[model samples]
Target: MLQVFVFNIPVESGERIGFSTTLLLAITVYMTIVSNRLPDFSYLDISYLSNFLLSDVTSGILLIICVIQSLRFYHAPVMQQFPKVWVPDLIVGNPYGSNINLAENGRVVQFTNEGEAVWQPANVFEMNCVAQIAYYPFDMQNCTFGFLPWGFGVKDLFFNVVSQELMNIYFSPNGKWEITNTRLYSQIFYGDQLLRLEFTFKRRSRYEIINTVGPIIILGMLQVFVFIIPVESGERIGFSTTLLLAITVYMTIVSDRLPDVSYPDISYLSYFLLSDVTSGVLLIVCVIQSLRFYHAPDSQQFPKWVIYITKVCSKWKQKVSPKDKQHINDEQIVNSDDIHVPTASEEEEREAPPINWPMISGCFDKICICCFTCICMIRTIVLFVMLTM
Candidate 1:
């Protein structure tokens, strides 16, 4: 009965499995009825059945045939005849235009006999992010990458992450940015399910500090030293102008590293720009201060305040003579010794000169150095507080 049952039935696939099983049961019953008519059925040679059913070679060949038949049956035209809903997997590609990330292969869709399909693609992507440089080297940024089916709504297709911790393994360390946090979420956009992955990154400031910002700060501080150049030496204007130009060049270099955004975020570059403008104004003041003491006729006396400040600055360097003190008191001094001052030709011939500009320039330098120092300090503190918040 078992031999007849095994020989009458073949392996079944798909919807035909139930029919094949019923036919095998009928054959088993028929074989049992026929065996009852035989006398001495106990002596029947059943040993030969082992060669066809249980031998290793026969079993191996049967297993191989079953697998091949199953594969062929699964892909047969009968299976394809059933109606199927097609969906596509959307894989995100690199948006930052960075070459460090791996390329994205197309998505794969898998179907089952029960009319269900799953779409999954490798989630390797480096998306574009808009940089807010208002805080620049100290800024933080949020970037997102997502997938959605082109034509399917939530009813026809749905999305999910294979594992929530997948990003933890795939994230690559970057030299300029540090990943601070990550989130995976889904939302409906125009009735379509959109699965998104977001990463929040903070700027790694060591590189900018060393290469861009450090040099800018040094250049700004150098502007303060411009005040120390003696006005009479005729180097202050040239020095201040050169320093201003240097700052402009530095600003250009730093700006090249920043993104163009519509809104102002607090950026270190803004501080550099403000500092550079302040330096330019200071340079103008230096030029004007030098001009104040440049050349004056002996009859044109110094302003009372100018003389007072100049005296205060030069107290340690030179003594205030009785005549010089009297000139400060009167605000007008005609040196009797110069009553018959020479013509232009005679003045040119005389070697000795009067009208001290160095003292005036020195006084102006002291005032500017204090003002510029205060401005720079205040800006630094404000920027630090803003960035921290």
Candidate 2:
């Protein structure tokens, strides 16, 4: 007797359909709320956006899987009714594709291209359990080695229907294994058990070192320039400013490369922070020097020779103090305003050899000029060397 029946199936289970609608509605509401609160890219707002994107992607993948599973099951009865034919359609190899069996075992189960068994096994020991599977090619001590067995798990591998019982054996000399597929290139693991994958260590190239350490060294050198230059003069400020600009550009590049992860130790950010502080200090010193020099008078209030003679006398005094001296040297300082030179009227009456005060003034002027010129020349040479270096 043949039986015929007609049945209608629901497109989606009631519970699943309701849940999908509810989840979509909830996400929509959440997105709306997020958009309302965080209008701009404030740090807090960016976090919300990131979370939203991740959540949406996860939900979308879940929904797609659910839809695919539903469609696959809808055609289940039709597939079950058909008998399997092993014609070895090389164009479409296996029903489950290459992933049907572990690569360690050959995929040809019982058939060949001509629908005949090449060699029939009479009660051949069948592998009914998988103790472990691992993917390995992991770096041990910075060296990557070929994959070794890392994991095994207990799994029931179905044998021929005629077999009586499965024997849980540990090791066998005649155990046969085959590689179903070969991966052209991948991070090889020791074996397909533990998830440890390894890669070979490559020697650090000069370009890599330059990219990593060059900026810091260059910036450090620039800072040394500012440090050696005297703050009293204006050169330090200009050099510091240039360094600051360089750091600013470096900071921008660093910020672009670095992710949002916050690092605790000295990082690129810390370098820029230090440079900023140093630049600020140099600028402050420059301002002070400028003010000091701006307020300083061009002409000396007292005789310039007094300042020069006092410095020379102080050096001599230090040397003489260390030695035993009997004479008490008396000294007095006379400025241009205080000098009492003889007038023409006073000189005419003097019978003794007349003194020329103007000549004395002229001699002091020459000495002062020479000292000033020497000081300028020395300072100029030092400044030039610093700038060039």
Instruction: Give per-model TM-scores.
Output: 0.60, 0.27
**Superposed Cα deviation of residue 349, candidate 1 (Å):** 36
Which stretches of model 1 miss by more than 4 angstroms? 1-128, 161-165, 168-171, 264-268, 304-357
lDDT tens readout by residue for model 1, 241-352: 8878877887777767776555645465666566667767766776675566655445667888877666555553444443344335676777898788579767444622
- In angstroms, what RMSD does candidate 2 have relative to the true structure? 31.9
Model 1 deviation from native, Cα RMSD in Å: 13.1
Task: Score each candidate by Cα lDDT.
Answer: 0.62, 0.40
Give the count of colliding residue pairs in each prediction. 6, 26
- Candidate 2 residue-wise lDDT, 1-389, digit = tens: 00001012255543444555455666667777777776555663466575865577467557746755776676444322212332221111112222222223332344343444432212212222211111101101122212222233212121122332223254343222321222212232232222122222323224423663356445644453343444346565567666667766655655564433343222433443354545445554644443443344555253556445544444444566676756644674446798689987574356223223332233333443354345435433543343234
Alpha-carbon runs more than 4 Å astray in model 2: 1-193, 200-205, 227-236, 263-389
TM-score of model 1 vs. true structure: 0.60
Q: In candidate 1, which residue pairs get closer than 3 Å at backbone N, Cα or C atoms, i.e. clash?
A: 134-265, 134-266, 134-267, 135-266, 135-267, 136-267
lDDT of 2 at 385: 46
